[model samples]
Target: MKKNKAHSALLNRYQKLINISCDLASELDLNILLSKIVRAACEVSDAEEASILMYDPNKKTLYFQAATNLDSQLKRGLVVPLDGSIAGWIVNHQKPIIVDNPQKDKRHFDYIGKITSIECKSLLGIPLMSKGNVIGVLEVINKRGGGFNKEDQDVLLALGAQATVAIENSRLFLQSDLIGEFVHQIRTPLSALNAAAHLLKSNRVHEDQKKKMIDILEAEIEALAEMSSSFLDLARLESGRKQYNVKEFDIRDLLIVCHEIIINEAHKLNLLFILDLPDTLPLIRGDRKQLKQAFINLLNNAVKYNKIGGEIILKAIAEKDRIIITISDTGLGIPEDERSKIFEKFYRVKSHRDHVPGTGLGLSVVKQIIHGHGGEIDFTSEVDVGTTFTITLPNEI
Candidate 1:
């Protein structure tokens, strides 16, 4: 009877693995695909939590891309160096390891434990390889009933193999999709450049008209340059290759810095800039530089979309476990129908497209950064009444 029960459990696990393999093959969204892979890892391995650490060849480092145990996205971009890290060793040697007590393993990265606030008692890590290339590591932590065994290793290795292929396919699909959209977006600016050049070369125009044509050329050139830079930024972020330098910093100070930098520009438009922040606030963890970029993008938008002499209000408050920020502007608000697409790539408000000079990529970049930090961003707008954007970042207060 005992042998029969053991055989049935083994068969069930393999069956579960087969179903997961089919599920992974159909997913094309990189983020969703990764989440599914990790969750599946936990279910099949009978572990408490699972994580996927992807290797960035350009940086020669590994970063936490997805995890089942993390409470927030604070650990997503946390870097694990190749030296003195188990994940790094797996990537370097391209093999599997079963460490029953990570505390005794000198190769363990204890900093990660502190960052995620999760203790690692047992760990089973496998290298995710594809086409002779070491791509990343798949790890399941703290097996439930007992230490990791050969069966657990066998199952995780099988999952990792399928996961690596799925990841590569998803990345390729994203790149192709983004490239097509980018090509479509640049055609308008290119045509404007061509038209300006043609008008400048003709002898039939007055000197004043020629100056106007030169101005047009300069503006279009500037727009194209900005578009190129923003495109690269979006691509890197979407590909998950962007490295974040994580540190603990006060949100209040970051807000002040942003206000100081943009206040002059707001003044040029005869706008009022107000910063309402508490004297004392909790310090948050994450990539400070990326968070700053996210804030600056929203602030710039508040200014850009506002009417002359409009008011921009920046307020912050700390709750028990999170910080809330709202940037309100008394300007042209987004339309009801278009609000859903605001964060989509290359999407611009139909009303503002003609009068406003923009690439429509700023908000997309902003959304990516905000979400990557394990935060949420939302906004409320009324036509001509104004718009207010709310951001919430996780904190330990």
Candidate 2:
């Protein structure tokens, strides 16, 4: 009878492991995948809480990436020394460990418990390995059964085994996507450059036409360089690698700076620039530089696709708990069919491909920034009428 019960327990664990594998396989978003992995680790190990610490090989440090208790911001940035912590030990040794008395264990890092205000009685940590390299550590703490046992360790290690592959696949997917986009975008500028060179090489070219060819060469080259830079920025932002310097500041000041940055370009196109804002709008909070980039892209697109003598309006106002900022332009509006894809990386409206000089990454970057700040962005447009982007941001207390 005891032997049968043992076999039954093993079968149940096998089923749960299979279920976890299926869940991880279907998830592609890196952040969501990591969060789910942590939760699954907790479930499989029957632990109260779980977290993942991503190792920085270059820095020789381990930093908390995700956890069960997110309200503890302190843990988010908390770094564990590669030489000191239990997670670090698992990472260094590339193995799994179960410590029933972490308080007495010299290898354990106690500061994490302090940061989250959760007492740690025991822990089971395993190395997240991919291609024989230790990328991170998976740790489940405070097992509800009082102490982590061999079964708990086995379950977490199994989860860790799958987590590493999922993380690598997600990263590879991101890189493959960005690389494909860059390759496709580079072809446009290269074609222009070739055409410009061919025209300038004409034996009977007049000075006027030669000058025009040179101008095209310069503009196309500049566009290519800008595209490369924007691609890097978008890659960093999307990968959760970019650190946001979040703070509270006046939204109007940011809008003013955005206006100053792009107003000259708008005026050069014989377009009217209007700023609509009350003098006493409430302050909003976010990364100043990132938010600035978001506005710059919106206003830049407004001018790039606008009619020759069009008008651009930037307006900001406050609601009860949220702030709304609208950027409207009398420009060539996006097609109804393509509007949904406007925020996709490297997606440019087919109609505007030739007329617009862009990397098609601006709107996607803007969307990433807004979503990063726990805000929402939306738009409305028609073919020839115009397009307006509405951004809703929460007011920070």
Candidate 3:
């Protein structure tokens, strides 16, 4: 009779835990869902602290994403080694572990204590698995009443499973939004192609008119091709399907190459081309080809939008732990309100619509490439004064 009563109580606790998890999964907001997961884990398991560590497979690092007791922002992006850590062990084994004494455990990482300034006594960790692969680890530390037991481990594993599904759902929602925008961007080129075909087929068209229609068809085709390529690149980067090939390269030499490549176009427009690079600019670690593409996009825009006989300047300098490269053009600048949307996919300034010709994907692609290298790109512009694009990359190479 006594054993039966104990089993009944355990069943009731399990049912309540499942109900809480169901509520958590219903949340569509990612930040709120993460917070609820950790909070529910701590509440159900009676732990002093709980944390979620998300894994970045590209970087091969585990970063703390959220926590219950610690300052949420402070714990975020704190990387832990993939070897000889308690969380790493759970990730590798794909199992739940209940540690009564974390300090006595060989796999316990001491660096965490240095950051949080708290001595961890007990820990319970489980792998956050999706589709049979470990995406991260969910852990609760310092059990409140006594120490973590089998019941706590079981509850944490259940919570980890629910959290994984919710995270995947949120990511899918975001991707669908981006895909919809990309689809809409292709319609303009398609309409132009249709119009060109109609004009070319007209029987009354003269030879000169026929030639002009052919040029329009060719231009539309080229624009479609360029837009398609940019769309693919952006999708790959945003979906985490592409990995950067990082290497050390000289920034000075890269600028020189860009200057030489665009010199002819500058001359055609009667624009003065200036290259202001230091003799000892630091080496930057990134994909050389992608960086070149980013620079070319900026230079192309400068030439396309500049007034005749204006000047375009490319400058590079070394800052602390980073190399800053700026490309400035005395061209038509973007309006203040439209500046924020310039880096968005298929977003172009309204003022430049009639004056410049582009697919509006150049800056978006450039931003994605720079972000893939763990860098940042920003710009400042004043109408009719000039626009400047500034890129900053780590000098870790």
Top-lDDT candidate index = 1
lDDT rank, highest first?
Answer: 1, 2, 3
RMSD of 2: 4.5
Q: Per-residue lDDT for 210 in model 2?
A: 83
Clashing pairs in 3: none
In lDDT terms, how accurate is model 2? 0.84
| Alpha-carbon shift of residue 281 in model 3 (angstroms) | 2.0
Ranked by lDDT, the better of candidates 2 and 3 is 2
User: What would you estimate as the lDDT of candidate 3?
Assistant: 0.81
Candidate 2 local lDDT, 1-397, one digit each (tens): 9999988987787798899899998888988898899889988888899998887677677877778865322234346777778998998898898888888988777776764578888888988887888888999888885888887888778888888888888888988988997898799679879877876777578988787778878888898888888889899777666545656798898899899999999999999999998897887767788889999999999999999999999999999989999999999999998988999988899989877778888998998788767678999998898999999877741
Question: Which regions of candidate 3 deviate over 4 angstroms?
Answer: 1-156, 202-204, 371-374
How high is the CA lDDT of each candidate model?
A: 0.90, 0.84, 0.81
lDDT of 1 at 135: 85
Q: List model 1 lDDT by residue over 281-342, tens digit each.
A: 89988788888888998999999999999999999999988999999999999999999999
Q: Candidate 2 regions off by >4 Å? A: 1-11, 53-127, 131-134, 145-151, 198-207, 248-250, 278-285, 319-321, 395-397
- The residue pairs found clashing in candidate 1 are none
Give the per-residue Cα lDDT of candidate 3 at 204.
71
lDDT winner, 1 or 2: 1
